[model samples]
Target chain A: MLQCSRLSFTYEDASQPSLKEVSCRMGQGRLTVVTGPSGCGKTTLSRVINGLIPELYEGKLEGECLIGGEPTTARPIYRLSEQVGSVFQNPKTQFFTTDVRSELAFPLENTGVQPEAIQERIDQVADLFGITQLLDRDIFSLSGGEKQMIAIASSCMMDPQILVLDEPSGNLDVEAVASLARILGRLKDRGLTMVLIEHRLYYLDGLADDFLVMKDGRLTEHLTPTAMRGLDGPSRQARGLRALNLDANEDASAPASVATEKTPDLLRVRNLTYAYHHDQAPALNVDDLTLSSEDVTGIIGRNGAGKSTFASVLTGLLKPGDRSEISLNGTKQTARERVEDSYMVFQDVNYQLFSETVEGEMLLGARRTDLFREVAQKLDLERLLGRHPNTLSGGEKQRVAIAAAILSGKRLVVLDEPTSGLDLLHMNQVTGMIRYMRSLGVMVIVISHDQEFLAQTCQRFITFRQGRPVRDSRKLGNLLQAL
Target chain B: MRPISIYTRFLLVIFANALIFLTLPTPLVLAINIYFCSFQVIVGRVRKGQAWLLVCLVFALGASLAMVFPENLPGHYLLFLFVGVGRVLPLVLVAAFMMGTTKVSELVYLMRKIHAPQWLVIPVSVLFRFFPTVRHDYAQIRRAMKFRGIAVTTGDMVRHPMRTMEYIYVPLLNNATNVASDLTSAALTRGIGDPGPKTSIQRIVFTRLDALMCALGLVLMGCGAYVAMFQA
Candidate 1:
């Protein structure tokens, strides 16, 4: 069993503690999920459990953490690695090597394991994760979900007694999330304890044994899967939690403001095709398509399905083929013109934020002060206008980027995975923002795997397969049923 | 041929660096470039050889131009500088070959086998993993700049160097800081700080290809030394 008694931690320079009087005990082979809003200490608790708090990040600790009945803080992190394994949120930064086989062997190599033994362990773990075919491939070429699989496999090289996965599904698609759930189920079958920190709760319906709800640096509620299923829509929203069942038909989570009446075609495309290299097939190929400002289109597909490439082409971040043609409202526009009239809020919002302050960022290249204030107030950024853009939380940074896009008066806005790691409250806020953009008559395209978010905002659905738009549906029920 | 040992590749790179300024015979230079070009091809990097071939053509053209033009031509110094860079191209190719083929695991194993200090080994391993992430981060920042109409053109840079620089620098610094901490934490949690002697799953051996390359490197070094001492 893993136990924590009155666990409280404050970072070295912080006046407020991130975790306060938190206590929980998770039984072996049980999957316990911790869900909360951003900055509610789910990550801090993971850090403490993984021995990263006092060792790498200096902080005040007031807690008792026990692993198999022994204090974890008493042992060094390296020593604790034998007992506890950790998989972080970001898949791109956690890996240490370039290839799958080598990355799996890395932890073993560091601990002085024999090559033959390491290879055997690798085979066992690869078979367990059903990733034997991926062993010979390069880690860089794998999709986000595949990378996370390897990350988990590498973390399991030593077969630790417990695994701590912090938002492992943050960067995954719906299919990948299902795959991850299956993998976790297999791990749980092996009697390995797991603590899953996550925001999306639909995928873990049957897998999670218990749900730990946290708020304001405290563990507020502990519920069994049955009790968690009993939560109503309003109560869950009030607690800042995602829907227990996506099929619950929570209309309250959707936008209250309706989209404006259908306008003339806002953007038109013809014969768009792009390939990264001449010798290879095109990554994106579209014969013809037209988008109206009347609908918030949700682009859905598996990883590498050319969803991102389509978005790039629409936003003019990537140049289409020579024969391609794009026009905005009957006006022929070049790539530069498309770029000027469109804005993209990247998934990693940090890259899009450049100015020192949020107010400055909204007006970086924009001169519309009146619109800036209007956008800020709508996105609830008025109180955070003076704070540095990088200093704000993830959701705040995303809102600031959207506000900047609004201030620019762009004809189109594309938000990539806007609610991937956000709680219910923030996801609702983004739904509101998308509605506000539509109310302003700007075309909105959200590239996401979030069915809840999509159902709440998107009126049109575009499904991609192998770089082609195979299915286009206006009925959200069709897409949701297909999923 | 089997994969060559990283040690042999390292020695060949060192030899190329040492003989860069030496005025070797044409046959010797041709031999060195050919061997390295074939090595590149053998490593499945045929595309890389095309670039080196293009560089060689430029160098050949410059040398022929210098021979035909007057000794006191106004732009002769510029030609000299161009040839000077070409003279060191072989060394640059050798380094690139090493980088493209050598795996981080092999490098780490070599360091540990040689009893290198942890301070050096740890940073070198992290640095190898760091470059690709930095490249990705920079690409994202550039895309962001383009989307925001930050003027990523050369003319804009000349007019507003500070603004352009700031636009690129701020996000990069933030990403760098976050990546550094994340990498360090990942490394530590995987028992990288263990005091015990490290081991590796990579099986490294000096094969016949490595021996052949070492012999070739020695012969080139000898030819280079002879030319420097006697021909000059």
Candidate 2:
């Protein structure tokens, strides 16, 4: 259904082509998995297939792309969209409507489908995706998993024959990932063609008919199901691919297990709760929590479960309630006080980054030149010191954030979903930073949903369910049970 | 009653904006604003909540304040505030209905039905998607700043204004650009364009409700004009 011949695209103002002489052909009803390290032109290749390269982006194209045996260059995006449905990486950016029903009806209404048949199609698609209950729900109120499901279902709602998904699993939980895999299987059974551009592969291991590896802007290898299964961990590492089973990615967490035993609680919490609105129900209600100085604590929870909110309170960014008591080093602190004592590296990392350059960012609110240089070197960001923080890649930006936090002499560091959307290599870089922070006697707290990262890196685990903190007695087992 | 057409809703909102500069009576202004809010609730678009109650309270308070201090500058200012809010409420009503009840595709369909210029309507339609994305981005930026020990406050504004602006602008601008690019790609791939006969899942047609609402708005405008010229 889809074919790319010697497809090469050079973005305007860029010296080199983002996608080199690469080619891919996906048959109808077959799912192709494309894996590579970050900046390996996976997104570019998918965009090319979806006709966004030469269409939306003003890039010079070197080859022809065919959809259903017809050249895509001569067709407008709207025409191509009839056959090709594209779901982007970020779910929030793609949504134009506030509610689910409207979101699903978006494309159909755009194509001038009659209202009666529109409703009929909406029902059919919602039923097909098992999201009949979500039809009327508000889009923003949904969890990340649900939003992604909607993005995918809405993209394919008009019964498009070919669907291109870019990192659909980037923000999903393991259960969500499994459900996504199941949904893909259902679509495949429906005889719809699919191209999944993903870094998270364990979920796709069984479902994908072919695994194609694109490295350094080239299709280096293509592996079958049996070949992918027999591939070893080291070889996977060398190729910059994620582990088939996330629990086995112990490159960063396994060796760092030799750290010291648990120390006394450096932070204490009692009855920490938050309600987004006073008239609404409480979003979070944590009874008691403790943080030790000598252990790397990981906070794990499903999306929209208030784990990040709890981190905000722990790091002093969000002030605890008047009745709720929280103490850092046996002294109570307000939001501003927490701001001074602890530093949090946020999930986006773009929010905390305001400096023009890396050195400027690390030097903010401090004159610790020696400390800044030392932390920068330790985080392996010493070379990017002169580069603009905005221009750095995802992993580089994250380390820059961490290194800046350490330079400011904050003993307690909290990272919220730092390894999310990162490839295996970048994931290790972030995991490594957390370990390094712990080694320096900093009370490091990490909040994430990555099961492997939590199990392999954390000495203590705290889980949240529906905004209520659950004590994970058996580590990640409780997490799996929660799912 | 049947629902109103999105075209009528858009026209009503623009008319309401024009009515802002008119010198309508305070009570008449409040009545019209309340009517728009009530109309939205009647259509089952926006839920009647704190927002509705607050509007009612503001109208009541402004009326009483005007009564007690009709000649005083402060009282007149309060009345003007009421008028200002009254002028904006109808626009809010239209926005709420558009964002909640009408799908983006439906709006585009209505725009084309009226033969509105594509270059103009496309951005307006895309803006229905843009503002929400901007709001989401703004919240993320706030969370990220809070994480980095940077807090925006009156004290910071007073102490280091330029530095404070720098801290705020850099991330805001960067994220804004990123969000815009991502949104453009997503929108383009979804086939948001001037050409091609786009289909609609939500069939938008003129109903009696549209006629009634449009007539009511025009009648209100006429009454306000007469009251401003002769009665007030």
Candidate 3:
């Protein structure tokens, strides 16, 4: 069992304690779900449990945290790694190897485990997590869900008594979330202690045994799933808790603006085939494809399955082969000829930002002063004008990129993985921006693995597999089940 | 007034530097050179106070040296500083400002507008995108090192520079390979090599205000050039 007695932690630079007198005990062989709003110290608590708080981060501690009846202060982080393994929020941030095999072996090697033992554990964990096919694959080439799965599998290979995941499904689609839930259930059944910090509560239905609600770094309540389900009205202060009670039927009652309808085709691709080099396999291939301007389309596929490549092609950031043909607004143009008519908001916003200040960054591709002013004011970027581009947070940078793309006055805009690191609030803000973009008669294509985002925004779904378009469906439920 | 193309802007800056080099006295040339070279902190349109303060200090030092030293000694010093600072600093400052303010798309648009060869813009855009990826890869490698108990201290870096290079280069090369593929696809999709004048939505027209500014700049250049010719 894990126990904390009046645990309080204050970072060196922070004015107040992140966790204030937080006391809780996680029982052995039980799954606990910690739910809270963004920036409420959910991640901090998870870090503390894994002994990263006082060790990795220089901070003040004013309480006793015990693991397995031993004081946590007595053991260093490396030592605690044997007892507790943690998977961070961002899968890419924690990855140490290029290949999945080496990635799975990393933690074991760190603890001086035998090579044979490491191999044995990797095989067992791979089979357990159904990642055997992915072991030889490149780490960067994995999809959002695949990467998260690898991260979880790598942590489990450590053979820790407890596993702590910080929003494991935050970047996954609905289908991937279901897969994650099943994996967690399997792990829970095997008697592994699990602590999940997540905002999406629906996935925790069968996995979470207890619910721990945190606010202002303090544990406000520790109730069983049964007790929490009995709460009446929307009085449940936790945003995630309220979302759990939402019936599937209520989703249909939402305004028509929630799921736009497919209108006339605005962009069409005929025999679109693209390859990086003459010898390499084609990055994208489509016999005949059409996209409507009015629909919010969700592009779902495994990593390297050409979702981003398609977006790049659509936005004129890439060139297709000679055999490839594209028609935009009934005009046939080669890939190179269509670039000026499109805009793209990149996955890494920093790559496209060349200006010193946020204001200058927004004006990078803008032509009209009037449009610039309108976009600037609408995006609330006027306040951030004087600040350096690099100084803004991840979500702010994303918004600036979106504003810039909108100001470019292109009829078509492509957003690639725009919601990767955003919190709940920022995610809402970004979705709102997408709506605004759509309202301007722009043909917007969103490339994301976020199922909640797709369900809340998209009306049509397109799936890709093995560099080929597999399915195009108008029914959201049908697509979710298919995936 | 339309703003000049990037090529024109590049030439204009070169001309301005040449004029400054010719008209200013040996001491002032050295002062201006040092000022521009060390004024990296005062980039873009904003006036950074710290950079301005540093420029003033350098100016005072140059002036004192010119006053106290003999003509030959100060002339040699000024000549050396001028070559180092004056010849290189202005170009560096101009390049920095241009790069720091111009987006890759804007550059692509301008290049396409001027009918620059596809080989030129394609390679340049790829290089531009490569820089940020390289920086990100370096950071990832550093974090991976820290996790592996390899301290990236200055002493360690100095002792094993080759190892440090390996640490950065290996990951960088790996990432570059992946990014290159993505960039190629992106470039092709955008119809980069399509025939005819590419219509850019960027709309970089030379407004009346831009023309007036360019005219004033040209007049300044003309005066500087005449002064340099006569004074010499």
Candidate 4:
């Protein structure tokens, strides 16, 4: 369904070509998985097949790319929209409407499809994607997995013969990834060809028909999954889905230290309840929650279940009006006053990055250079001090935000979705930082949807449903059961 | 918090005090305020080395023009036009500084500290988040247009601004709504409206230094007001 012949593309300003003499062909109704290390032009190749090269990104194109026997370069992207649909890496970027139903109807409307046809397609795709219950919900309110699913469903509404997905499940949970794989399997059964560009192969192993490997911007190997697995070498073995040598270890809770006379709890909450004006449900309703100096609390819930809201309230970003009473180190305080005592690394790094340079951002509210040096060394941000915050990659940005929050000298730190866009290496670094925070006797609360992250970084888990803390457990099994 | 640079803070305070004087009710004070403000804004946009010369030349030309043509007929209209320009120019310059230098999150934080109502805080925060996201959306749309081989020529843009608006508006509205929902959920999750004194880790306290600065601002404002009232 897709073919590229000696397709070399060099960016307009760059000194070297992004993709060099890359040649590959993808068969119809088959799933082709493209895997490569970071910065190997995986995204560049996907852009080429989708007619974004030479067209969207200004570049020198030297070769032909054909989609289903038609030269893609000759056809406008709108025309190609009928034959190929693409879902980008970030779901937030691709959406064109507020509600799920309207989002599903967007592409069809652009293509001048009749209203009836559009409605019919929306219904069909919604059913297929199991998003009927989500049709009326605000698009932004949906969880990350839900948003990705909607993005996929919206693309499916175009009824394109081929679907191209760029890291579709990059930020999803394991269950969500499994769900995505199942969806892909069903799509394949319907004879829809797919090209998935991904780094993690946990979910794509059995489903992908063929493996296409690119290294240094060139097509290095193209073979069936079985054939690729038979090859030798550590790189090949890594590509073929051998267990990664990196530690994926979950936190084995330390043997209960000899109980010294317990010091008084440092933080206490009593009858804490909060609800938004528009919400028919409460966001958080916890009765008598307490944390000692050494508690590493993990807050987990479905998206929009108020985990982040709880963190914000605890961190003093949001003030609870009448629904909660919070005593910090035994003193009642307002959100503004609490700001001096608690810090938060927001989910979106952009909000927290207020300065032009990394050093300035890290030292925004910092009092001591010693604290700054400690976090800067740990997060490896000392070298990045001169660079602009926006210039850094996603992982780099996350680290910078973490470093800044830590340097703020807040007694209690809350991290919201800290590992969302991070790779294994960066994720390990952040997990280590969390451990370090706990070792300093600083109370830490992590709000995340990543079960693995929570399992690895935290000792206690709290689950919220409809803004109410329904379960609290130290055991992973109990946490799972509660959720 | 890192102390605001002394020079920048001084400029801000001076500019703010000058703005307050210009906005005062007296006619004479308003006129002088306008005159000086106009000089500041227009001259500010010019490079520093040549700006003084340009300002002097403009001033001389205006004075000469008024002296040569002192007739009642066009002089009143000219005066009115100059005053209008003067009144607008400083406001525009200051607005630019405000928009460019102040981060939206900081503005929201300031508003929250001032105890703004939740309804107001919610919308403002939403707008702040949506601005960047919308800009990103617009960029993506433009890229999509280019990839689709739709030539985004200037002529086409001028002729079909609606088409451009269509591209911008659809995605913006979509993203805004999504962000709003996210904000709502985030707010709700964070217990934003809980009725107790909430504790914050990152406190924006008005330090002794900040108090002293505020006192200096008040004193400056008092002096400006006194000078405007009696010195002239």
What DockQ results for candidate 3? 0.01
Model 1 whole-model lDDT (C-alpha atoms): 0.85
Best of the two (2, 4) by lDDT:
2
Native-to-model Cα distance after best TM-score fit, residue B153 in candidate 1, in Å = 5.1
Candidate 1 Cα deviation (angstroms), residue B31 = 4.9
Q: Write the per-residue lDDT of candidate 4 for residues A56-86, one digit (tens) a residue.
A: 5788888888887888888666666667777
**Candidate 2's iRMSD:** 2.5
Best by TM-score: 1
RMSD in angstroms between candidate 4 and the native structure over all alpha carbons: 19.2
Residue A464 in candidate 2 has what lDDT? 81
Runs of candidate 2 with Cα error greater than 4 angstroms are A247-265, A273-287, A321-323, A366-369, A466-469, A473-479, B1-8, B40-106, B152-169, B204-216
For each candidate, give its TM-score against the true structure.
0.93, 0.87, 0.62, 0.61
For residues B116-164, what per-residue lDDT tens digits would candidate 3 score against the true structure? 8867866875565455446666665553333222343557778888866
Number of backbone collisions per candidate = 0, 12, 22, 27
Better of 1 and 4 by DockQ: 1
The numbered model that scores best in lDDT is 1
What Cα-based lDDT does every candidate model obtain? 0.85, 0.76, 0.67, 0.64
DockQ, candidate no. 1: 0.74
**What CA RMSD would you report for each candidate?**
2.7, 4.0, 20.5, 19.2
